[model samples]
Target: MAGNKSFFETLVMEEGGNVTFGDGSKRNVVGKGTISVPELPSLSNALFVDGLKANLISISHLSDEGYSVLFSKDYCSILKPDGQTLLKGMRSSDNCYCLEASIVSNHVSMDEQIELWHERLGHMNFRDLRTLGKFNCVRGLPKLGKKANGICGPCQQGKQTKSMHKKGKYLTTKEPLELLHMDLMGPMQTESLGGKRYIFVCVDDFSRFTWTYFLREKSETFDKFKMLCNKIKNEMNSNIKSIKRIRSDHGREFENATFETFCNGLGISHEFSAPRTPQQNGVVERKNMVLQEMARVMLLNNNVPRNLWAKAINTACYIGNRVFLRPSTRNTSYELWKGKRPNVSYFHTFGSKCYILNDRDQLGKFDAKSDEGIFIGYALNSRAYRVFNLKTLSVMESSNVVFDDTRLKSNDHEEEVIFSDVSPLEEVVVSPNVGTSNVNNDDTQPIDRVPLLDSKEPAPWVRKLHDKEDIIGEVNESVKTRRQLANLISYTCYTSQIEPKNVEEALNDEFLVLAIQEELNQFERNEVWTLVPRPKTTNVIGTKWIFRNKSDEDGNIVRNKARLVAQRVLSN
Candidate 1:
C-alpha cells in the first residue's frame, strides 16, 4: 500500500457502550467493522476500542467465520476447516494472543479507514484489492497491510445458512467420478450470453473438478444429465465401466421419473439428501458458491457488462479446475481428471487490456492493423485466446493476441506481449481449453527435434520424426543426418522472448556485437571471403544473422550468441 498515512484521525467518535477487554479493563467502544488482511477474508466484527494498544479478535468470532482456533504452549492460529492457517497470532508476554500489523494508523489503526474506502470502492474483495494494489491498479487505494483477517461481514451475510457442512460425514473417494455431486443455481439478475437463466453444476468426488452447464429452464436438467453421462462414458478410462453413484438434493430435477429411469438404465445409484438438508450435497453445493463469488469478482474487476455472465462462468470453472486443491488426490483437479500434468505457461490475467491482429478486417493501408480487446477466457477446441472486442462489442477467438497485463495498460503496444507464440491457429494441443490450461503440444512428445544451422536451399534441417525414433535412435547409430535423407524436413525452434528481432538491434548490445565480431574474425581466419570487384550478372546469395542465448545448469542466462550465415536466394 502506498500513500497511506502512518496515523489516522480519531475523526468519528460513536456513543457505543463500553466493553470488557481480556486484561479486565473496560473501555468505551468507538467504532467497529471487519478489517482487511492478506490471504484471509476481512476480519469480521473487530471492535475499535478507544485505548487498546494491540489488535485483538475474539475466539468465538473466528468460530462463527467457519475457522478453527488452535492454542499451543506459545503459538496459535485461526485455520480453515482443512487445517490451513488463515492468520497466525503470537502469544504475548501477558499470555494473550496478538496479531502483528505491518502498518497501523491512529489509535484506530487504518482498518476503519480501509473499511470506509472499501465500501466506497464498491466493496471489492480485499483479496482483489490486495492483488490489484501492487501496481496502483485502482485510484485512491491506500497502502494495504501485508496480511488480512478473512472475515468479510457482507460476504457472510450473503451466505448465512441453516446448518454448517459436516466435515467428516463423507469419506473421500479414490477413483475419478466414483461419486458425483449435482446442484443448480440461478434466476440471476442478469441473463447469460446464451439467454440462460439457470446453471447446472456437477462435481467429481475424487478429482473435485467441477463442470458447469447453463440452462434456460429447470426442466432442461434431465436432458443435460443424459448428455453428461454419454460424454463421460465415451471419455472415461474404461468403456465398460459407467458412473457408480450420484448425490444431489431432492429437487424435482433429480427426483422425477425421467431422471430416475435414466440412472436405473445405466445401473447408477442415486443418493438424495433429506428434505431441506443441502449440506449432504455439500460438494457441488459449495462449488456453486465458489463459482458465483469468483464470477462476481471477475466481472466487477474488468468492468465488463452483466450480459456476459456465461463467459464469466466459463472462465470461473476453468480457473477453479486448475487452481483449487483436491485433497483426495493431493494435486490439482485437472491432473487427476486428465491423467496428464496441466500446462499453465500460456495463461494470461483475465480481463487484461489487449489487442488482436486485424489481419482479416483491416480497413486500408493506413488504418490500424490491431483491434483493441479485453481478454476474457481461453478459446474452446483450440490453443487460442478468447477476447471481447471493445470496439465491435462481440467475442471472438484468435491466437494473434497481445496483452498489457499491468496498471499502465493501454491500446498502445509499448510492452512486449506476455506470450510470444500467438501464431495463426494450428494443431498445438490435443484437447480444447475448457476450463483447463493446455500443455504445449510439444510437451507430450518425448523429445524435440534438434535445431538446425547448416543449409539454406529450402531451409536449415529437421528430422522426420516418428514415435519410436528417439526411444532407440541414439543407441541404434543408424539414424540419418542432414545428407542421409533424400528430402529435407524443416523445423524451427519455438518462438521465444530472447531471439533478436533484427540485426540492427542485435548489434546494439555488447554481448551480441562481440559475438558477431568473433564470427567475422573466424571467417577472416579461415579465408572464407575477400573484397573483390563487383560482377554485373553474378546472381548473388544473401546473408542473415541468427541470435540465440545459452544457459548453464540452473537455467539462468549465461551468454548471448550471434551467427552470420549465407542463404541461397534464387532470382526469378
Candidate 2:
C-alpha cells in the first residue's frame, strides 16, 4: 500500500482500521486507491495510510493476483502464472526487499511535450515550431515530433485574421516626394498631455521617411497636411521636384471638398484607396501600425504614463527615419530623403531619468541646480532634448541635461554613467564664433552644423585642432520643421499653465496654494469631518488632494482648483 495520496491515480475514502507492521507499529488507513507507475501494471486497492513512511506490499496478496514471489538471500523476484519474471527487487541492509519504480506523472509523452512548448511560445504555428526544434534554434527545446492532434482554441481565435495581399516586388517611386501616403490614426481613449487625441501620419513612398503630427481633433488634419505640403514644396523646389501624388483612405478628413481644392490648386493628384482596404495605402498604414506598436511597448516597458504616448510615437518616428533601411537598398530613409547620411549620436533611451538645468527658475546658493525629469524626445527648433520635469509637472526643451539611463534608481551607488560611443575627454567642436558648452550640448546639435573651414585662413579654434575638423566624420542633414510654430504655441499650455500632480507640488505654486487653502476652508464650512479621539483598534481613513486647472470655454485655464478626497483602501 502506498503512503502518500499523491501516488494514487484513483482513490476512495472509507472508514478503516489501523494497519499493523512487523514491528507492531500501526498507521491509520485513510483511503484505498490504484497506483500507476511507469513501466508497471497498475496496483489496485493500495491503502493510503496516514503517518506511514514507506509503502508496503504483501506477498500473499500478489499470489492471490496470480503472481508468485520467491525470496532469495540477496534479492527477491515476482513471476507471472506462466513463469515469466514480472519484477525483481534488491534486499536492503534492513533485510527488506525494496522495489524501484518512477511516478507516471514524471514522464511526458512526445505529443504532450510539443503541446506544452506550443503554448509557451504563444501558440506558434506547428510548422515553425518543428523547424525551431529541428534546427535547435531555441535552447531547452526538444526535438518536436509534430503538431498536437487537438486544435488550440486561442490559435483559432487569434490567428484567424485574413492576410494582406502580396506586396509589389518593384520600387514604384524614383525620388523622394514623388508619391506620398497619408493616414490618420486616432481619437484615442486617452488624450495626450497636450490634449492631442489623433496622430496625422505622412510617408514618402520612396524614402519611407515618416512624419507624424499630434492633433486635438479631426479638423486639424487638413491644416497639418497643408502645412506639410507647403514645407515640402519649399524644400523640394530646388531639386526640381514636388509632391506629385498622394494616396489615402476615403476618410471624411481626406476626401472633403476643401482638401480636394487644396490638392487641385497645387496641381497635385489625390488618389483614394478602396473603402476598408488599408493595403492600397499600405505604406503609411503600416508605418502607423509600427509607430503605435513601438510607442505602446516603450510606454509599457518604462512604466511611463499613457498620456505621454505622443512623445513616444514622435520619438519612434524620429529614430526610425535615421535607422530603418530602405527596402532592397543599403540606404536609410534619412539618406534617401536628404541625400546625406543621418547622425544618431545623440539618441538616448526614451523614458530615461534625467536632470535638466534649472536655469529658467531663480535659484539660491544652496538650491538644486537641476530638476529631476524624464527624457521624452528631441526638440524640433533647437539643439535640445525634451524632458518632462517632475517638479513642475510640465514638459520643456532644454540643452543642458544629464541622463542616468543605465542604472536602476534603487541602487545606492551614484557614479555617473555615460553613453558608450562618446569618450570622457573628447573635445566639443564649436561654430566659428560660438562658445562651446559641454559634450552634452555639442552632441545634441543637428548634424548639418559640422563646422566648415574653407576660407584658407583657419579660425583661432580651428588652429588649435590641427587647422581643420574632419567634416567627413559628420553627416549633412536637412531638418524639416513640420509644425514648429504650432508646437511652440501648444507647448505653452503644458509648461506655463501646469497642473500639479500632488499636494507637495501644489504647495510650491502660489496659485495652487491659494486654491488648496480655499478648498480646506470650504470643507470646514461644510462640516465634512469632525475631530475625534483615536481608537486603539481602529484604522484611520486617509485623505488625498486632487489638483486641477479650471478652464474656460475658449480652452484657457482661468483658475487653479483643489479638492480633498478620502483615499479608498481596499480590504480582503
Candidate 3:
C-alpha cells in the first residue's frame, strides 16, 4: 500500500531469528507480503514490523528452497548443495554479516524534486504541478517547496509565445448552458478512431465543463454543436433555459450567416474573437492546449501507438474535467455542474500494468484466464476499465480486471478523513471566458480555410508556438483596435481562488473523491461503451476527462464537473 512506504513485522514469529537489543527487547516476525520489483520478479517475503531498523533474509528459508550456506574466514556464501553460489555476503568491518547489498541513500531537495517531476509530467505548467510533490502521489517524492523556478526546454519549445495583454478579463454568468466556448483543432499528422482529422471542443463557461467531438471535416462542427445544445437544454429543463450565448474564433464554420442564424433561432447569441486574436476565446483554446499536452504525454510515455492518439486526448479531457481546479471557484467543475458529488475511487494510473479477465473466452482446463495489458483509462460507457491488451494488441474495457498499482492502492480500506463533511451545493456564476458572453461585434469578416500545401503538413505545436503569437498568448499593441471592455471586476475576483491541481489533491478531501467516482458512474449509466473481445482490424477508441468548476449568480463557487470523451483518432 502507498500508505505504508516501508514494511516490518510484529505478528509473532513462527520460526525466525531473534536478536537482543541493548535494552534487551526482542521482536519476532510473523506477517509477510510479497516483495517484488522488476529486478527481483519474486522476492518471497517482506515483514510488516513498524519498529525494525534493518531488513533481514532468512537463511533457513533459503536452505529449505534448496540452498546451502557456507561460512568463510572473511565472508559468507549462499550456494546450492552442488556448490553453485547464488549470493555472496561480506563480513563487515564491525564483524557483522553485511549482506553484500548495495544500499544507496536518495536525498532530493524540494526544488530538484519539482524539476524532476516537471520532466516526468512532460513539463506541465509549474504552478499547477507543485501539488504533486506535496501530496506524495509518487513514492520517493519529497515534500515540495511552495514555488518553482527555472524554464524547461520542451515547454519553451512547444508552448512558447509572446506575452499577452494583462488587461483582458473574465466575463461572468449565472449557470451552465448560459454560455459555451467552442473551438476546433484539426488537419493532423494522423487519423482518429473514426478516421477523423479534426476535433470540436465545447466548454461551459459557468461550470467550466467541456465536451469534445472528433470530425472528418470542419463542416461537421455545426451538427455536433446542435446535438450538444439539445442534450443540455433537455437536461437542464427549467424556467431558465437554453444556451444564452456562444464564443468562438472568427472561422467560417462558426461566423458565417447560416451558423449565426441557427444560434439566433434558438435564442442564443453568437460572438467571435477579433481577427487573428484567439486569446479573446482563450478559455477553449487553452482547453485544447491542455487536452493535446495531456494526450501527448500519455501516448508517448505509455508506448501506445500513434493510432491511439484520439483515445489519449479523450481520456485526458475526461480526467481533467473531474480533478482540475478552476482558479475562480472553491468547488471543482464536476461539483458545480452536477448538484450531487462525484465518486472517483476507481481511477488508476494511465499506462500502468493491468490484468483483464478473459471471461468471454471459453478457457480450457489449463488456459490462462486473464490477459496481461496496459492500463489506459476508464471505459467510456461502463463501470469497467479500458486497457491495451498486449496479446490482442487492441484496446478493451472490462470490469473483471485487477490493477497492479502497488504504489497507489492503500491496504487499509477504512475511510480516510480528508474533510469532516460534504458541503452543500452553492450557486455558481459562469465566467464569460468559460461559457456565456454578450458579443455585439458583427463587423469582423469570416475566416476562410487556407488550403494545405502538398509539400507541407501542419506545423508541429513546437513550431507553431513561435508563429502563433498573433493568434494566441500575448496581445500585441500593433493589432489593437477600438474595442470596448465591459465591467470586468467579477472576472478579476474569480481568478484569485485556490483551485486544485490534480485528482490526488482532491482525493485528500474524501468528499471530493467520492464525488469523482459518482461522476464516472454517470458514463456507465449512459452506456458510453461496452467491453468485448477486440475485433480484428478494428480500432478501439480511447477516453479521458475534461474538468471544471461552476459558480453562482454572485460568483461564489459551486461544484466540480467532469466530461468523459473519446480521443478521436484519424483513420488510415
TM-scores for every candidate against the unseen true structure: 0.45, 0.47, 0.47
Single out the weakest 10-residue window by summed lDDT for candidate 2: 447-456
State in Å the error of residue 21, model 1. 46
| Residue 81, candidate 1: C-alpha displacement in angstroms | 37
Order of candidate numbers by TM-score, starting with the best: 2, 3, 1
Residue 105 of candidate 1: its Cα lDDT?
29
Indicate whether candidate 1 or candidate 3 has the larger TM-score. 3
Kindly report which residue pairs in candidate 2 clash with one another. none
Q: Candidate 3, TM-score vs. the true structure?
A: 0.47
Residue range 131-182, candidate 3, lDDT tens digits: 4333323233333333334565445545556784342244487777777999
For model 1, what is the C-alpha lDDT against the true structure? 0.59
Q: Count the backbone clashes (under 3 Å) in each candidate.
A: 14, 0, 71
| Two-way lDDT contest, 2 vs 3, winner | 2
Model 3 misplaced stretches (Cα beyond 4 Å): 1-171, 238-240, 405-572
Report residue 113 deviation for candidate 2 (angstroms).
Answer: 35
Question: Distance from true position, residue 549, model 1, in Å?
Answer: 61
